[model samples]
Target: MNVKQWMLVVCFLCSGTKYIPNTCRTFGSGVVQPFQGSGFYVRSNCPFTLTRLTHNRVECDVSIRRGKNGLLVQVEIIINKVRTVLQNGNILVEDQSVSLPYDHTYENIFQYGIYTRLRSSLLPLTVTWHTVPAGIDTLWVRTAIFIRKS
Candidate 1:
């Protein structure tokens, strides 16, 4: 197929995909790796934080406007943590390290489900995305966090 035709085909297939627990904007702290963070739905412009409702210090006075990137996940982090989320699904806790552009705009460099889960270290969070595991699991959080150490 040509570039235009290929683009349409890609969009059609991607539209069917959704983000797990990609709704919550004002999310609390802590990890919901076990609970799957929440549920998935059609993608939107809102950002997602991998915080569970049951964690302490849940209510964060996070000024989203100050978020270096267009995502709050990066804002919540004070510094860079040992690059959370290993290639094998391990998470580095309390790692403040975040990598993102200073601009508040987002770019879909990997809209085709590149990462199983989004890491705090990454910025301009993937608002509209689909992970490979979501196909086999309904309670899957496309951008879920992992508590276990690598």
Candidate 2:
């Protein structure tokens, strides 16, 4: 965690709102939830939502309200803050199967998942997003990360 992240984490905790310690950040209107990973993890600068479609399935959607100016939503799916995959135009998760959102979300997915199940437990991953205007264009991004282990 950097100084800014530490400050944000402190702010969230000081206000009586519970947030994952040392993790979670608020960039512009974007709210990113931090996860413990073994070098491969995901972090977003814009707003993203992980919706539960079923008991054991979920979907991740990222929306950049503006800066696109109705032109297009271009995104760079960065993994471990190293690898980069450029995704142009609108994000069409529907075009592909929900079983692997990352596959369609990014140009090329280098994660662990399949049509039946995701091999996430075997290799924890990390990601960070970079938009056109970056995090300097928006004021707030509403995001939520809900995980239920059963």
Candidate 3:
């Protein structure tokens, strides 16, 4: 093969064309009572310019099992004031579905759902949670943010 052809192959091999998230970060909030009327709480947040995060994964877990309904959790990505739901991120069980440790202490259970497209809103991107668990279960939420540069 010629030098130029070899160089082209090497470059292509070095940098694959597949779009991969360049920055991946995980953040969590302190213990919170989702069943309360507090509504949504921020789990992870980051600032972006023209380029924005394209995917997110949410994790929910609780230490106590206070009711039969289990903890119903919903994951949302809020860019500025707009909200986008990560499908399958809404979990019913606290530890089983979310796959968190089965202990009396709070833990973070991550279950990545389908990837969703997101656009920048000239503000910081935030991952929030809303729950319908009627119990007084103490919960801790975590979110993973995957970002790509435009």
What is the TM-score of each predicted model, taking all chains together?
A: 0.19, 0.21, 0.19
For model 2, give the 10-residue run with minimal summed lDDT: 114-123
Give the CA lDDT, 0 to 100, for residue 91 in model 3: 34
Specify the highest-TM-score model's number. Answer: 2
- The ten-residue window of minimal lDDT in model 1 covers 131-140
> Which lDDT tens digits does candidate 1 get at residues 1-150?
689857855674566633234343332222123332553332223434433232233222111111222222232222122123211122222443223322212221222344333323233123222222212111122233223222
Residue by residue across 1-150, what tens digits does model 2's lDDT show?
A: 799869966776666665322232224333333333332223443433321111123332223322323221333222222223223422233343332344423233332231111112112223333334332221111233333323
Over the stretch 87-144, how does candidate 3's per-residue lDDT look in tens digits?
A: 2343333223432221222222232242222223232222223332242122233223
Off by over 4 Å in 3: 1-24, 27-73, 89-115, 121-150
> How many clashing residue pairs are found in candidate 2?
13
Instruction: Rate residue 120 of model 1 by lDDT.
Output: 31
lDDT at position 5, candidate 1: 57
lDDT (Cα, 0-100) at 142 in candidate 2: 23
Q: Model 3: which ten-residue window has the lowest total lDDT?
A: 58-67
Cα shift from native, residue 122, model 3 (Å):
2.7
Compute the lDDT of residue 138 as modeled in candidate 1. 15
